[model samples]
Target: MLDYRLFKQIDDCFASGHADKARRLLMEVQSRSIALRDEMNMLHIRLKTLEDALQLARNLFNRDGFYWLKTGDVTQGPFCPRCYEDEGALIRLERTGSKLHCPYCHASFIGSARAAGGGAHHAHILPFV
Candidate 1:
């Protein structure tokens, strides 16, 4: 989910009557939100596969099994731990500085992955045969 601060900023910008600024920020937020949702869906599928594999391991070996990490129904990262990649979840403009942080993992990057390139930070694909 995109942070509430993003919506607030959009509101603030529009409230200030800067149409161009508000439009640009809103567009950026929308783009980031879409990318985050896609990544989250992929993570869900990947974690499900991992869970299935662990179940099989438990059945076959009849021993202690390694399990995937998850916080509630979601896996435990907004940034890919393997790559330290990040997606924007919240926008903050405090007195210190402006920065973006992921609400899930609390990882902060220089900028949104999409703005840096054209897609999310790293595309992780699991190989199946």
Candidate 2:
């Protein structure tokens, strides 16, 4: 967690054996190191909190992980975060390209290379028929 750039600078000074400047830089490095350590501890606490929330979400959704089955006329869920957005929309839709439209709401679901996840890439359309 040390600011690696500053750590490197201090290391270079130490390696050069410039005792006076090295001493000063060493103090700076040590101070930054302590500050970085405290920051890391804070992040650790945050990570623990998120893990707890994710676990609780799994339990509430009756699922074992980040994914969960969405219920309704759709009958499928446990979708990844991106897919969940479409699930939230009034109508589920996917656009294969600039030309395609939502089968349900007739909304344009333009395709984009930026939509990169395998399962979450294209909105899988389920037939209402």
Task: Kindly list the per-residue Cα lDDT of model 2 for residues 1-129, writing each as its tens digit.
Answer: 455676677678778876678688778878888998899999999999999767545543312222343344333433333343456322333435443344545444333322212232342333344
Stretches of candidate 1 exceeding 4 Å from the true structure: 1-4, 61-129
Q: Estimate each model's TM-score.
A: 0.42, 0.38
lDDT tens readout by residue for model 1, 17-102: 98888898888899988999999999999999999868544432100111123434543222323222233122221111333343
**Candidate 2: C-alpha RMSD after superposition:** 13.4
- Top-TM-score candidate index: 1
Task: Count steric clashes of candidate 1.
Answer: 0
User: Model 2: residues >4 Å from true position, as ranges?
Assistant: 1-17, 61-129
